[model samples]
Target: MQEFAKKPTAHRHPLPHGTLTLTTNASSMVMCAVLEQDTDDCCQLLAFFGKKLTSVEQKYSAFDRELLEVHRTIHHFHHMLEGRQFVMQRDHQPLVRSFAKTADAWSAQQQHHLSAIAEHSCTIKHLKVEPLPTSEEYRYLFTIINRSTRWPKAQPIWQQKAESCMKALIGWVSRHGVPYIITSSSWGVNFMSTLWNSLADNLGAKIIHTTAYSPEANGIIKRLHRSLKASLTARFQGGIWRKELPLVLLGLKTSPHTALNISPAEALYGQSLTLPADTFQHTMSPASPSDNRKAFERIMPAKATYHIARKVYIPNELQNAEYAFIWVDAHRIPPHSPDYLGS
Candidate 1:
């Protein structure tokens, strides 16, 4: 087979002049891209990138794979191609639809891949590499949301290292007040790191670990994470998630909750946010603001009164009793037996 060059390698840095072009390809297993610039005589090489698809990625359709390949390439060369207009050369024609302004339904992953490199000024063209792909494809996500206000903050980290996590957490604390408690799952090395624990300790914050494989322990954060991702995926057409994050957060913070019947921002700050898209005037009423602190204090006496009247599990002596009765579910009980069983 004839080769482009036996030992020729692309320059690691930016080219001074000529048109910059990114050519990409992807198979089931692996994907590759070459960045080249049109010089006076020949197209001089700038850089190259390639990666093996993960098992999850390998299962994706051809269009998805090609789309992923394109996203990775733009992200890999984001620093060089960020501000300037450039050309993207790919084989799969299907991938171009993402760049087009259309109302067609896109997969969550597809929306995400497009959002990453959406900020860059680039144009996509057909190039036969065997096949094609979007943006700042973030590898790690650091998300924070207030338990009381339900206000959220999500940061995209390039690496899953502890330092990045620490930085993200510290930045959040600096902007918002230091949290009294920090809770997270055990999946991330960033969260499980010694540095993370130390940071929490130093900040006088208690670290709470969720039950392994159970999302319910931290369901609020998980739900917010899902919604945040969905909002970013749906509304954003281009640009890195970093830019989109604040916009999404704004909508989340200001949007009224169905249960509370008030916006989190209004609940916390006692006012509605002034936004570009807000058309109607919102009048705040002092009696109806869903401030949790005030509402809890106002309702505490009623809660105590109701519980006292019912006398349900009131001031139980279970701790002191040597042989206390335990409440068993119907499935755990005998074929025909009392609902409560001896422990």
Candidate 2:
């Protein structure tokens, strides 16, 4: 830290040529921000900010709270960001649409926040990432989600029984807010547990248990498990699989789901995520065009093995086209049920 600050050409003052990317994430109780400069290989950290929310502040709706975090974090480094027209990355979605909307739609409090941030940032490129805590210690990943938006999250728990399930459920509900209903498999520990009953009684959430071994009963999470497994398989080739879970979740949230045209991040908060492709200045060194496409294909949510489908490799010429054609086999895809993969 001392050496970087001592360097005359370092980011003590904002640089003229590089782009700044400010990424922020808000938990139930606090918010954090990181400012970085875009380098060839990765982002270089410039500054970081963190704050605990007040009692009243913590009660703000998720979207509003995330926006407040952004507004304050930008002002904290206003001098550096002013006139820079940098990028923004948040964990929630509403901040994107809120900024795009006219002031007329915002409440007085939101207006106040915007006024404070107006000077520091005008142009913004938004991205989102939901926090995914691993089950390294617990050895189990209990998944939960906002079913309406398909905004899924996971937590590591020690076991699949009543007490462990209760803690994992609480962890997600506390951070993401409560769900009106929870659908799960008819596992003996979960369905028969008195602890589970007590939890449902207190949270006022209705529990719907599916028939034994019928995954279709809770298809949403089943699909998520598939996507998670697919992403995990790609990263397992090398690197810590535990740490990669967060990025895997980010890919699922940011990538457009087959059921919904929009990504889960967008569906929940009207926000978009900046994908790796968005910031990659150049392709991987010594990799061919086909190899690069195949590599990126690994990040895609659906795997070719999951279904009998054709994978299309889009040409560079059509990268930015309004739309490109996808061929679907008539025998496999039913009428009005067309399906195809893209890379």
What residue pairs clash in candidate 1, if any at all?
Answer: 66-133, 67-133, 71-134, 116-135, 116-136, 117-135, 117-136, 118-238, 118-239, 119-239
Query: Could you give candidate 2's per-residue lDDT for residues 1-343 as a string of tens digits?
Result: 7787687744434568778988888865899998888867766778889999998998798877887898888889888887777888764656776766765977788889877876565555556433333335545677876666678887666666788888888888777777788877666667667789889989999988875544556667777877887888776644356777888899888988765566888766655677776687654367688975764443333322232233548688886887666665334634556566443
Q: Residue 67 in candidate 1 has what lDDT?
A: 85
Candidates' C-alpha lDDT: 0.74, 0.72
Per-model TM against the reference: 0.44, 0.41
The CA lDDT at 212 in model 2 is 59
Off by over 4 Å in 2: 1-135, 237-239, 276-343
| Weakest ten-residue segment in model 1 by summed lDDT | 299-308
Worst 10-residue lDDT window for candidate 2 reads 300-309
lDDT of 1 by residue, 1-343 (tens): 2385466654745566668989889977899999888867887778879999998998798889998898888888887887788898877877875588576588888888887758777888876532001236565677887766666777777777889888999999898778888888777667888998999999999999886655566767767876886898766665555666678888898897643466777766656688875657576565654575675543211110111122236556766778867665335435677778786
